[model samples]
Target: MIFNHFHDAYLYTLAEVYHKPQFYNQPRGNRSREVLNYTYGIESPIERICYVPERKTNIIFNFAEALWYLSGSNNLDFIHYYASNMSKYSADGRTLTGTAYGPKLFAYGDKRLNQWERIKEVLREDPDSKRAFLSIFDASEVLQLENIDVSCTIGLQFFIREGQLYMSSYMRANDAYRGMLSDVFSFTFLQELMATELGIEVGKYYHNVASVHIYETDYVQTKTVLSKAKQIGTVPAYPFPPMPLKDNRSDLQVVFEYEQQLRQGTITLKPVDIDRLDIDDYWKQVILLFAVYQSIQQKKVIDHTLYQKLIPLYQMLVQQKWESYFSIIMEEM
Candidate 1:
C-alpha cells in the first residue's frame, strides 16, 4: 500500500533501507534538504541524520524477525542462525510456556493478553477509569534475557479513554516499517475484542515504537512505503459482533433461572471501570502479583526460585508505598 501518513512513511523507510539500502544513497545534490537521503547516507558528507537508530542492525533484525515468523514462511538459514546462537538465548527465564529462544519470542506478545483481561474488567466496572492499563515493559526480565543484544522493550502498554481502548507499545528500538503492520493489527484486535465485551466502540490506535529507525540497507523500499502510508484508506471494522455471556450453573434452581434469562435474551453483562480508584500507584504491585502467580503455576518449588520471583514484587510494592497490599497478599499466600 502507498504510504499516506508519517507512521507508514517511517516504516516503509526502515524496511527499504534495511532490505536494500544501496538504491537510496544516490545524493540529491548533498544539499541536506532531502532529509531521507541526507540522514541515511553514511560517510558521504551528509550533515544531519534525522532518524539515526540507537542500535542500528539489531533494530533491523528485531522487526524482520517478527515479520518473518508471522509470515509463517521460514528463512531456514536465519532460523539456523537463531538456533546456533543458543548461548545467547535465555532458556532459563519467565516465559509463558514451551521451548526457549525464538519459539518463546513468538509468544511474547500473546502473554500481553493477561493485561487485556484486567483492563476489560476495569472498563466493565467504570468506563472512565483512567486507571485502565497493562504494560509488558518489564526491564529486569528483559535484561535477563541472554539474546538481548538487540535493543527492544519487553512490555507493551494498553489504556482506555472514555469507551475507547488505546494502546502504546514502548520499544527501546524497532525496525519501524515491518513491525508496525503486525503491531497495529494485533493490538487493534485486542481493542476491538475488549470494546465489544464492554459494549463500547474501538477508537484511536496510538503506537509508539521508541526508535523508528531506517537502516542504510532498506532506504529505497522505506521511501516506497512512506508514499504508501500517506494515502488514505478505510480503517477496517473489527470482525466479531459483541460476544454474549453464558451461564453454566449446575444447581437446579440456578440453572432454571439462568435458562429463563437465556430464553428471554434479556441478560446483559454490565461493564465497569475501576480506574478512578487511584490504583495506578498499585500498578507495579498488580503486575508483579500476576507475574508471581504465573511463576508459582510453573511448579517452581525451590525456596530461592520462589524468592527470586517474590522479592521483586516485594520491592516494587515497597517502592510504591503499597506495603499494605503487599502484606495482604503475602498473608493470604
Candidate 2:
C-alpha cells in the first residue's frame, strides 16, 4: 500500500512485519532472528520526512548521516560522533570496508568514476534515459572474507516520467525497526538533491526489500511504537517547497566546514555565527539546530530562540511529535 508520509509507511511496515515474523539466522550474530519479506511504495516520500515519535529517531544522526554520504566520506569519526553504533560496522576499526555508500557513489572502485556525477551527466544528456542507476554494492569486496561491511542496499534507480523524477531503491536486507528510517531518510534526500540538480519536480519513491525484519530483541519496542501509532491519529501530507534549481553545493560545503570547525574546537557555537552562512534560510536554521545539538553535548546553555524557530520547521517537514521531543531536550538542560 502507498502511504503519503514516511512515518506512516514505517509504522505500517513495522506492524505488518511484527505480526508474523519468521525465525532466521543472520551473519552478524549467532542467535536466531525474527524476520519477514516485505515491499512497499511511498506516494509522497518526502512529505513529513521523519520517524514516528514513538521510535525516538535522532534528528542529528539522520541529517549527519545524509551529509556524510553526500560528502563521500568513510571515516568512522564523522558518523561515529552522531551514531556511535556505526563504529561497530567498521571492518578494521579504522574505516568502513564496503558498506560506505558515500565513497561508492561519489568515488567507486579503482577507476573512481563518480556514480552521482555520471547520473547527472546522463540525465542532462538524455532526460528519459533508463541507465540512471547508482550502484552501491561492490561484489568484488563482498566476495572477500576480510570485508565485513557489506552494503544492505543493492542500488538506486531513477526514472523521469511526466516531468518528474522518481526513485526506486532496492535492498537485499532491511531491519524494519532499527534501520529503515535512516535508510529512507538518506536515500530520499539523495533523490531530492538529484531532482534539484536536474531542475525537475520530485516524484514518488519506491522501496523494495528482499528481507525486512524486526529482531526478537526489539519486539517490545516495535509493539510499543505500533500501539502508539494508533493514538497519533492520521497524519496528512505536509506541503514542501520545490527544491531550487540553483546548485547548493557551495552552501553545503560551507555548512560542512563550519561543522568540522565546531567539532575540532576551532570555533565556538554561537547564534550570531549562523548569520555569516551564505546558504538558504532553511539550511541556516538547520545549521543552527546542529549548533544547539553541539551545545547540549558540550554542557553549554542552548540558545532557546533557535530551538523555538526550528520547532515549526521540524513540525512541517518532520512531525508534530518533534515539538515535544525538542521541548524535552531543552527542559533537561
| All candidates: TM-score | 0.39, 0.88
lDDT, candidate 1, 56-75, per-residue tens: 21211222233333322323
In model 2, how many backbone clashes occur? 0
Which candidate ranks first by TM-score, i.e. highest?
2
Which residue pairs collide in model 2, if any?
A: none
* Top candidate (lDDT): 2
- Cα lDDT, all candidates: 0.36, 0.74
**Over 4 Å off, model 2:** 22-27, 30-37, 48-51, 143-147, 236-245, 313-333
Worst 10 residues of 1 by lDDT: 41-50
Model 2 C-alpha RMSD vs. true structure (Å) is 3.2
